[model samples]
Target chain A: MYTSIAGSVARPSEVRLQSPRPSIPPSTAQPEPVGSAFADLTVCRHSVTMSDPRAAIVPAPAAARATDVAIELLAEMGQDFAGSRSIGETLRRALHRIVDHLDAAGGALFLLEDDGRTLLCTASVGATNIEGIRVPVDRGIVGRSVRSGRGELVGDVRTDPEFFQAVDERTGFVTRSILSAPMSVRDERLGAIELVNKRGEDPHFTPEDLRILEAMAASAALAIVNARLAAALVEQERVRRELELAAEIQRSLLPTPPRAGFPVVGINVPADVVSGDFYDFFELADGRILFNLGDVAGKGMNAALLMAKTASLFRCLGKTVHRPGALLARIDAEIAETATRGMFVTMVAGILNPATGEICFANAGHEPPLLHRDNGTFQAFPADHPPLGIAEGSADTPLPEATVHLDGGTFYVVSDGVTEGLTVGGAPLGVEGLQDILREAGRLPPAERLTAVTSVLTAGPRPLHDDATVLAVVGGSAVTRPRSGSAAGRREPASEELVRVSVPSCADRLRLLRQVVALSATQSGCCQEAADELVLAVDEACQNIIRHAYHGDPTGQIELSVHHQGRDLIVLLRDYAPPVDVSRIKPRDLGDLRPGGLGTHLIRALTNRAEFLPTPPGGGTLLKLVKRIR
Target chain B: MNTGMTHRVERRQTGMVVVALEGDVDLQSSPEARRVLLDAVAHGGAVVVDLSKVGYIDSSGIASLVEALQKARQGGSRLVLAAVSDAAMRVLQLARLDRVFVIHPSLEAAITGDR
Candidate 1:
C-alpha cells in the first residue's frame, strides 16, 4: 500500500503532524531553511469522502472491575483516539486523539509511496519539524513492525541497537519506551503509527500499551484505504470518456452517398470499434465521374490512419488526372514513392459517362468485380495488374481496359470477405453460391436483395473472418453509338484561288487541310482565307473522327497531313477505312426533315472550302479533289 | 569572330554589329544577347545575331533576340538574325521560327557594311 501524503494541501499544522512535542520548536523570531527535513512532505488538496455520521453508534465496553479498572484507564483515552473526518484538519486531530488514547508522550503518522519501498513521515506533533524524514522499508523499529506484521514493544530504546538514533540526535528527545504497530487494511500495509515514551512519566511500555496502539493502527488503515479507492474510480472514468470521444470522430470521416446524377454506388464497413476501408465518389470537370474504393492493409486505429491519408492523396491526384489508365499510373507512382513498407493498399478507380455510358476502370490487385448480365449470368472481371504500392510507372504492369455495356444490368462488387465466407460444415460459399444467390435475389429490390444474400452467406459456423462490404449498381445503357459507311463524294472549288473541302467532319479533316493549306499560297486569290478554311475544316473533321470510324471510342490518331505542290488545292484524307457510300443518299429524302445520317450532306453544306482527298495508306478510298478560285 | 565568353560581338559597320553566341544559350545565361546587342544598337547601330556558336536554346532564351530587335527598331535601326544553331534551329523550325525572325548565312556576310 502506497500511502502518499498525497496529503491534504495545507500548512505543516494542517497537512502533516511531524513534531508531536517540540524538543526544539522553531523560534517565532527566526527563519528556517526552505527544505531541510520537509522536502518529501507533499501537500495536495484531495477530495476525500467525509466520515459517516452513523459511525458514532458504538456499543459501550463491559463494566470495568478493580484490575480491569486499570485496563479501563487506556479505554478512557479511547474517546480521544477516535479517527478524524477527512479534511485538512484530519491529520492534526488524529494525532491528538492517538496521544491521549495510548497514554503516550507523542505519536506520528508516516505515509508510504505508490511502491511500498519508501516512506515519508506525513504528520507529527510535540517535537517540532520532523516534517519530512525519509525512511526505507527495512530500516528501524517502524520497519520491523511492517516486516513482522505485528506491534513492537520495547523498554529503554537507547540501549536497543535496532532503534535509529538519528532522530534522537536531531531532536534531543528522550528515548525510553516504544510501542509501534504496522498500519494496514487487509493485505495492504501503509506505514507504522508509533507512540513514544509514557505520558504518566513512566520509563517503560507495558504489554497493555501494545494492545492499545494496535487498536489505533486498525482505525488508521481504514482511512487510507477509502481514499485510494476513490482516486482509482475517478481515473478509470476519465480514460473511458476519452476513448468514446476518439471513436466518435472516426465515424464522421466515412464516404457520403452518391448524388442523383452519378451511375455508381459504393459502400464500406469497418469490423471493429473502428475500420480502415474507405470509398469516395465525385465528378471531374469534363462531365465524367470519378469513383474509387481502397482497402487498407490492416484494421483498427493504425488502419484508419492510413485510410484517411490515402483519401486525401487520391483527391489531389484525381482533380488533375482525367484518363482512367493515366490516373492509376500517377496514383501508383505516388504511393510507391511514399507508402510505408510491408504495409500497402489495394484499390480500384474508374471514370464513367453519366450521359453516354462509356466506362474506363483500373484495378490494382483487388478482387475482380462481378458483372451481372440482364439474363442472370455473371462474369468476374479480374485485374490484369499488381496491387497499388507494388511498383511505379505505366510500364511496371500493363493494366488492361475491359469495356462492357451497362444498360439494364447490375454490377456486383465486393471485398474478398464475401466470396471467402464459409458454411458451418467447412465448405466455402464460392462463386457458384454467389451466382445462385444473385439469380434468386435478382427479382427483389436491390437494397433488400443485398440484405437477404449477406445473411445466408454469413450464417452458421464458418461465417466471415473479417468485416464484409458489398456495392451493387443496377444499370446498363449507352447513347450515341458509332457507325461506319462508305461514300464516293467529292467537291471542287469553282474559281481560280478557292480550295474546297468535301465531308470535312468525316474523320479526315486534318489530312485534307494540311494538303490544301500547303498549296493555297501559290493559288491566284485569298491565301489566308483558304488557309483559315482548311484550319476550320481540320477542326470539324477531327470531331467527326471521334464520333465516327472508331465507334465513338478512338484510342488512336487520324492522319490529315499534307504539303503543297503549287496551284492545286490538293487535299488528301487518310484513315483505315470503312468508307461511307454516298450513292445511298436520296436527294428527295432531305425534304422529310430527318436529323441524322446526313454526314456527307453537312460536309457538303459547310465548305467548298477545300478539295476532298483520298490518301488512305492501304491505297483504298482516298479522296483527292482540288479547286481554284480566280 | 574574336570571341569573348565563347562568343563574339564585333561592330563591322556604323549601323550594325554581329554578336555570335556559342555553347548552350539557355535560360540561365541568354542575357549576353541583350547586353551586347542593346549596347551596340544604342550608338545608332543595327545588329545580326550569328547563331553559328550556339548549341541549343529554348523560349526564354529566344526573348533576348526579340528585345534586341525591339531596341534596334526604337532607334530607327535595323537588325538581322544570322545562321542559327542546328539544335536551336530545330525548335525555331517547329514553332515556325522562320516566319518571325530573319535568317542569315554568316556574321561577316550580314553585318559587313549594313551601317
Candidate 2:
C-alpha cells in the first residue's frame, strides 16, 4: 500500500488506485504488498503512474506534509529578514533558505530595475558568480512567472519550451527542473524567485513546492520595497543640504547697500535659492565712483560661481583700468578662458563724477540702462556690442559711452528678469511697465525708489521666474551732502585772488586736476571747447611729469594753480621731481608711428604758449599753461 | 579717468589690414594697442591704421604706431595712418611725425597708397 508521486502532481485524480485483496486487471498487473511501516508510503516514477488499490490512500498524508513545510519555511523567512541590515543581505539569506528547503541545486532572486523592462539578479545561492546578471523581463520562464503574476513548475526544463538556457550557460550550472514564482506585493509585481533543480529522490519539483515559493516571495517583496524607499529619502536629504550650503556662500558675495549720504542703492532677489545676478559700487582711489551691474547666463551653482568671479575681477581691474571698455575686454578674455560651454555674461559698467553730476557708462550687450532725467523723462542706452565671452579680445565696434548730467535725477539698471516678469493675467511686464514704475519712483529718494520698484515686483500676482537685480544712482540736487575736503561744493568769492590745489602725480588723480581747471576756465568766460582744452592741457602736463620727470612714480607731488586774471585763465603746474632736460623736451615724429613721446606734444598743441621754466628754490620743472578768452 | 577707447580690424580686397581705432588711446590702452598693431605687422602686408573715429591719441598711443612701423619695415611691408582726427592731427603736427608716415584722409586712400 505504498505510492511515490513525481514530476509535479498537478491532479490527485490522475493517479489510479488498486485494491489489495481484489481481482484487478490480471495476475501480471498485481501490486506488491508492503509492510506496516511502509503501508502509507507511495512511490511513483516521474513519467509513470501506479495502479494500486491503496495508492489513493497515501496522497492525503503527503499533501499534509507539504503544507506543514511551506508554513514553517514562511515563518522562519519572516524572522530572518527582520534581523537583516540591508535589502541585499535579506535577499541573499532568503535565496539560501529557498534552495536548501526545496532540496534544489541553486536559486536566484532577481529584482525589477527602474526601467521596468529588465530584471537584475541581486542575490544568488549555489551558482558561480551569477549575481549582478541581467535578464529581459519577458525572455525566460522566470519572466513568464513574473509577467503572469503566478508560480510555474516545469518538470524537466529541457522539454519546457519557455525555459531560457542563458542563465545555465552564464553560471555553468545544469538545470533539470525549475519552479519560479513572481515576487509581488499588493498587485505590483517586483520580480521573480527561481529555483534551478530538484535534488532529492523525487528528482522533479512538485506543485506543492510551487505554492510554498509564491508565499515566501510575497514577504520578500515587501521587505525590499521598504528598504529602497529609505535609501532614496536619505539621498534626497543630502542633496538638499548641499544646495543650501552653496546658496549661503553665494549670498555672502553680494554687495550691501551704502549707508546714508551715498546716492547708490542696489538690490538682488533670487528666483531659486541661489542667484546669478550681481551689482557692485565702490569709490575708486580718485574721487570718482565706479559701479557695475551684471547677469550671468543661467541659474543655480555654476552661474553663481561665474557671477562671483566676474564681480571680483571688476573690483580688481577697475582700480587700475579707468576705462570701462578696456576693463570689460579684459574681463571677457578671462571668462572666455575658463567659463563652461555656452556660458557668457552681460554687463554695464560706469564711472561717475559726483562733483558735476557727470556719469559716463559703457554697455556690453546688456539691456540699455534707463536715464531718468531731472525733468522726469526716461532715455534708454542700448547695447553697443555683443555680450562678453562671445568673442575674444576687444569689440569690433566701439563700446558706446554716454554722458548724462543728472541733476536731481536717477540712472536705473535692471536685469531682464524685471522686464520679463509676469503679471496676474500672464502678460509680461515689459520695458514700458518698468518705465512707468521708474517714473513713479523718480520723485522719491534713491533708497525709497529702489524700495518702490521691489514692492511692485513682489506684490505681483505671479512670482518671478528668474533672478531680479536693480541698481539706481541718484544725482544732482539729491547729492547735496558734499564729501569732506571736496572743492566741488565750495564757491569762490569774486574778490578772491587765487585758487590752488595740489595732487599726487597719478593717472587716476588727473580727474581732480581737470575739475579744478574746468572751474577756473568757466569763471574766466572761456567757451566750452576752450575749457575742455584747458583741462586736457593740464592733464597732459601732469601725465608728462609722472611719465618723464618722476618716471611713472605716482607718489610725487604736483602743485596746480588756477587763477582768472582779467579775461585770461592761467594754470601753473609745478612738480617736485628731477627736472627734465628742456633741450630734449620735444614731441616725437608722428610719422614714426610710435606710442610714447606724445604727452609733451599734446601739452604744447592744446595751450596758448606752453612754457617750461626752472623752479628757483625747488629745483624742479614749472609748466605754465594759459588760455585766453576771445 | 575718462579712458574711453575701442578698436577693430578690417581686411580689404587689396590685402591691407585696416585697424580702426576710436576714443582716446592713452597710457591705459596703449599696451594692448601696441600688441594688436605688432600682430598685424607680423602678418607681412600693407597695414593701415584708421583713426577716423578716434577723438584723441596720447604719447603712448603714438609710440605704439612707431613700433608698428619698425616691425613693418622688418617684415617687408608698409604702415600708414588714415582718417586721423583733428585732435590727434594737432599732436602729429606738434611732434612733426606727419612727415614720417604716409598720411591719408580716408581708409580708401590709405589702401590705394594715395597721399
Considering every candidate listed, which one attains the maximal TM-score? 2
DockQ (Cα-based) for each candidate? 0.01, 0.28
lDDT of 1 at A420: 70
Question: For model 1, how does the per-residue alpha-carbon lDDT over B8-113 read when each residue is reduced to its tens digit?
Answer: 7686645456677776553335456567767777767677778877754533345566666777787898778777766557545433445566677766567664
TM-score of chain B of each: 0.80, 0.91
Cα lDDT tens digits, model 1, A1-630, are 013322332232222223232322343212122121111111111111112112112212331121133222222222222222342255556666667755777777777767888777877766555658877777778778887779899777767778977777788887777888787777888888877887776666765456545654655565466555655776778756754564565555545665432356655544555556666667777667676777777776676666667777677777977665666677777777877886667777776665555556777777787777653458888888777777656533335656655544566766665567665566766777776676556544455456655676556565356555666655432111111132211122222333444432332233334445546543445365444344333433444444555454444445543433233343455545466442332111233222233333222322332223444456424433232222
- Deviation in Å, model 1, residue A520 alpha carbon: 55
The 0-to-1 C-alpha lDDT of every candidate, in the order given, reads 0.55, 0.73
DockQ of 2: 0.28
| Candidate fnat values, all | 0.00, 0.64
Q: In model 2, where do residues sit more than 4 Å from their true spots? A: A1-85, A185-189, A395-398, A477-480, A484-630, B1-115
* lDDT tens digits, residue span A1-630, model 2: 232333334333222232232322354233233111111122111112223323333456776555445444454455555545677887888788888888888899988898889999999888565889999998889999989988899998889887888978876778888899898777777999999879878888877677667766766776676667777888888877887887787677666667665767888888888788888888877778889999999988888888889988988888887777777888888887778889899999988887767888888889899987643458999987777777776533336677887755678899988888775567776889887776544434466667666667777777778888899987753343345454543322122245788888776666566778878778778887778777777877777888888988889888998866444566778988877776566544344455566666566556644555546486788876656554
